[model samples]
Target: MTKSLIDILDLSTGEIDELIETANRIIENPQAYAHKCEGKKLATLFFEPSTRTRLSFEAAMYELGGHVLGFSEAASSSASKGESVSDTVRVVSGYADIIAMRHPKEGAPMVASMKSLVPVINAGDGGHNHPTQTLTDLLTIRRKMGRLDHLTVGLCGDLKFGRTVHSLIGALSRYEGIRFVLISPQELTIPDYIREEVLEDGHQDYVETTDLEAVMPELDILYMTRVQRERFFNEADYIRLKDSYILTREKLDSAKKDMCILHPLPRVNEISVDVDEDSRAGYFDQALYGKYIRMALILKLLGVE
Candidate 1:
């Protein structure tokens, strides 16, 4: 009965809490678990280019005293020779004790997990979900604000294709009083399934709007995502909407002092660089928390005390 983290929903609420606690403990005393995974190995099978995610995973394994092996890009691996995901997983499983994979196709890692002998972590599957990132987000939110429940979380920009927002919303839905403000252009509004399935039927109080500043005062957590030019059907439309969503200092003047700003990296102009000096800006800290959470996950999966 091996558990695989294929989605954010794979872990129970209690399990999520435990992981957060473990991550905090590891963060406070890194040397305490220095040899936790001394004899273990982690394989990062990235089928896409992700400098941040790949480096964080490898750094996590290394910090836990574990060895790492894998291809960071699809073209560098057997996939370039036309090997199937299942075949790749089967081969990697024989070499590594656990696998963290990222693929551009939705459900590719799930298919790999079926044939894998070790636990398969979905790093980021297409425009789908990234469970590990969701975990990192949970850890960050809990540590920063001290509660996950009863918070007004605003998800802004690229909702139609932001995998982090999709995954975070799924995980947050299990909590209480989580009112969501989905802010994006008409073209980039949240998908219907998410709105209907998670917001409406899940009975969470939520609203959709294109005006970012109009909803800023109500948000406890402002989660920002990049509005990529590639998502638009027309270039002119992207140019028209890009600056409206960008978070400027003027917009934060009306926001609550305690409201925290978060972004899942490689940010374009969605967040202004000037906001980095704000005390509530947690994106950089979020990246550090990502490494800590990854270290905790590696230790847990490797069965190291």
Candidate 2:
């Protein structure tokens, strides 16, 4: 059977843990895994612009002594010439041992996976899912906090359209004693389906609030997200809500000294630069972990792990 990671739920809990364990081992023993995927190739079919995820995938493959090939944007690929995702993946599958794709349309990678012969990992699909980012978040929390369970995770800013938050929430809901403090503008609160279906169905505990300061004191981990101007249909709404939850040094004074702060990057001021100097700031470290976890992912998908 072929395996693809289009959603966080595509991997079982055990599989996710195994990936994290492999990632950690790779981090600690880089020399042993240097040639893990030496002869393989990864195709990064990114239809949308990406900084962190795209570069991280390339870096991961390179670190594993593998090669990477593909276009950074749809305009640079045959997609711009009207090639369908299925056609593109069908063709690329023959060239690369594995594929990590990001597309502006929701479920575009899923569509590619159906036609692809090799494993397809979803880098991001519209604002629908980014399983690899979720993996990075989970690994960061596990490595920093020493446990994935028994933590109050506060998801701040743009929850409604934040794919990382949605995927993280879904992944964390499977763990015991995981509480969610969803902090966002009322209009940007988690979608009803996620709140009702994922959280409620699992009988997990959660709270929704517009106030970041109110929840700062109670969080074990704070996952911040940018108010994406691209996600907003109205320019006025984007302008009004972009600064709704900036994390400042003053705000961190109320948080636990051991609390970890994480963000899926290319951040635009949701987190104040002053907060970067804090020991609790784990976003930069989280970005590093993104590469290690991705290396593990590529190795796994290519049957190298």
Candidate 3:
């Protein structure tokens, strides 16, 4: 059977640690592993529009001395002509050493994995999960805060549809003393399944609040997510909270000086531009880490490292 990274659960804690270590090494000395995947080819089958994720995968493949081929958006692909994901995977597997796919439908990659001859990677699948992003988050947190354990991480903004938050909570649940402050509107609160399956079952300490300022001082890491206008059911609701949860300069006044701030980019103003100047704002640096980790991922998946 071929291996696939469909979920964070697919990797043991030790494997996760090794991957992070490899990623750190790749970041520190890119040239040492430049030809790691010398003759490999990577096919990125993105069924959604994600500039950052797509480019990260492409850059990763290139840095590993591998070639990359794939479409950036669904409309540009065979999917627009009604090609099934399974058929797409079967076809791409013939041409590439591995396939990384992103789809708007939940569990799409899982279905593709069953048919794929090469390894499959879930770039994302609706709000279901994004394991690679979770891996990137884990590596970023460990690199920045020095450890993932015993940190109070505040996940602020759209909790219901933020796949990154769901994946992060799952990844951190395996660690100890990692408290969460899930800040979101009641309508956009963390789903019942997440609360029941992860927070409650793990017995992790967490608080749900609409107030961002009240939780700012208590956080070791503040993970901001976009309060997407498209996620709201009504225009008035979007207008109200779009400005409500913004992390502004005034709001950061009382926050700990050393607290780290992170965001999955293409942000629609959830974090203020002024806050970017702060040393603790690590999202841009975090984005670069995504590419590095992805480079490590491609090498590992191709059995080269």
Question: Which predicted model would earn the best lDDT?
Answer: 2
Ranking by TM-score: 1, 3, 2
Q: What ranges in model 2 sit over 4 Å off?
A: 228-244
- Candidate 1 stretches with Cα past 4 Å from truth are none
What lDDT does model 1 reach? Answer: 0.90
Question: What's the true lDDT of residue 191 in model 3?
Answer: 91
lDDT of 1 by residue, 1-305 (tens): 35578998988999889888999999889898787888889999999989889999999998888899999899999999999998999999999999999999999989988999998889999888798899999999999999999999999999998889988999999999888899999999888998889888888888899999999999999999988898889999999999988998889998999998999898878899999999989999999899998887776666666
Computed on alpha carbons, the lDDT of every model, listed in order, comes to: 0.90, 0.92, 0.90
Clashes of each: 0, 0, 0
Better of 1 and 2 by lDDT: 2
- Residue 18 miss distance in model 1 (angstroms): 0.5
- Clashing pairs for predicted structure model 2, backbone only: none
- Best candidate according to TM-score: 1
Query: Model 3 clash tally?
Result: 0
lDDT per residue for candidate 3 within 1-305, as digits (tens), equals 57888988888888888899999999889999898888899999999988899999998999989899999899999999999999999999999999999999999999999999999999999888788888888899999999989999999999998889998999988888989999998779999999999999889899999999988899999999988788889999888877778988888888998898988887778888998898889899889999988887777787885
